[model samples]
Each structure stands twice: as C-alpha cells, then as structure tokens.
Target: MTVANRFLSIDLEKCQGCLSCMMACSLAHEGESNLSRSRIQVFQNPFGRVPDDLKIHYCMQCEEPACMEACPAGVIYADTEKGNVKRIHTEECIGCMACITACPYSAMIWDLENQHPLKCDLCADTPYWNQDRPACVEICPMKAIEVRSEE
Candidate 1:
C-alpha cells in the first residue's frame, strides 16, 4: 500500500499521552472538550515500549482514501479545495460503518451522537480555532504531531 505522503505525521518519542491534541481536536470540531468527539486520539498501550506505548489516530488525507471507496452511500468525498481532505456528507450517510471498517489507519471515527462516521477535515470550516493548521497540531504540547512537509 503506497499511500501519498500524509498531511500529518507523528514522532512517537515526543508524545507523553497527555491528550492535549485530542482535546483541541474535539473543541475545534465539535465545540466541546469531549474526548469522544475528537477526530484525533492517543491510545496508551501498557504492554509497549516507551515511544511505542502511545498510539495516535488521525486522518492521513490519503491521495486514495479507502473510506471514500468503501462508502455505500457515496457520501464520502475529497475536498479538492482543501488539499483533498476526505470528508463525509453527514446528511447523505447511511450509518453503515463501512468507511470506519475500511480505513487503513482507523482514522474514520464513529460519531456516537450523530450515528455517522467522522474524519479529520483540517479545520477547514471550524469556528473555534481560526488557525492555518489543524487544532491538534497547534495544541500538541510535546510537538509529537506535525503537518507533513508536502502540505
């Protein structure tokens, strides 16, 4: 699987799992500080090594998005205007979870409240954080996550 260079990259060694990135993501996109609403996540693995102990989940902005291909309702589309960010048309989604299941990086998250899948859109239309990059990148305390050079 040769994916194009992703919009976001991570350095595991720098992450401490404080979850500031997740909080910022949720606040920016969902307007609340709820971990469940966050598009990016940090999972702690007790059995892993120092850096490998933390796992970050975020949209890669794939050139060929698996989520888009797996959508039965054809609601997931790429926003060419915003660096081809993969987004879901919530109104048209069928809540089938195919996109969530097909995502290679597990980037598509289930919106428990909306009954739909959610993927990172780089805060293209967010009202909370009026920044050039995604909120997560800016809020990362350890600077573990960063916008990829190609973007």
Candidate 2:
C-alpha cells in the first residue's frame, strides 16, 4: 500500500532559537531532557552579523538517502508504510560511523554512549502523548516547525 510521506518543514524566520523542540525531542526518545541525544539540533550562525542567526537542523528524509546507502551493516532502511521514512534499526547498527560521514547536511548525530548514529525518524511513526505528531512539532512555542505530508 502507498502511504503519504511526511516531512518536517521549518520556518527559519519564525524560529526563536529557544530550543524547545530539541528538549522535547530528547525527552521523548531518551526519557530525559538531554540535548546531546536529541535527533533535532539548533545551531547558531557564528559568522552572522545579526544575533537572531540560528538554524534548526534535522533529517530531511531525502528521496535518496545517503545514510541508507552508506550503512555497510544494512541497519538503515526506508519505512515504506510511513511514506518511505528513513529509519535506523538500532539493533542492527554496527556503529561504523559511515552514515555520519555520508550525510551532506550533517544531520546525523553520533551517540557517544551507544556508539551509534542518530537521526530524526519523525517520532518513529507513533502517537506522542496521544497526539498524532512529533514531540518537537507539538512543543514548539513559536510554531516554527510543522509536519507536511506528500502524496
């Protein structure tokens, strides 16, 4: 069956860099508020002249994902039912760090403790807190992030 592909769309202009999304993401995935483990990250543009130069970074879930191709262990695969969302099977991951190097956007985050790389999976296609949305999108106070579905 064909399923609509979902992607997280960010409005940079609306982002306040409060990092509420990152905190929420860590809480949901790690059962604690640890930004280091968050799949989503916020970076401040150091060379920018303006103080509001911040960027929210996360997986794009590309049509052709480099991470999936770079995984020698075949841990990363696309979820066809969830609109081809790219996901990493942690159990099968070999922690080769290939996905981290292959990502052009540097969206993949390394887990120092687990020795595995992490990326956004749109909350693993599960309902968060009874809501059918990602924790980051739901907790954003500025509403800077949104999930868009492509048919």
Best by lDDT: 2
How does each model score on lDDT?
A: 0.80, 0.84
lDDT of 1 by residue, 1-151 (tens): 3232437787888988888988998898888899988888789988877676877888888877888898889998876666666778899999999999999998878989999888788777886334346788888888877776353
Q: What local lDDT score does residue 54 receive in model 2, on the 0 to 100 scale?
A: 82
Model 1, residue 41: displacement in angstroms? 1.5
Candidate 1 segments whose C-alpha is farther than 4 A from its true place: 1-6, 47-49, 128-131, 149-151
Task: List where candidate 2 sits over 4 angstroms from the true fold.
Answer: 46-52, 125-132
**Residues 87-146, candidate 2, lDDT per residue (tens digit)?**
999878888899999998889999898888889988874457332479999999988888
RMSD in Å for all candidates: 3.5, 2.2
Tell me the lDDT of model 1 at 55: 77
In model 1, which range of ten residues has the least summed lDDT?
A: 1-10
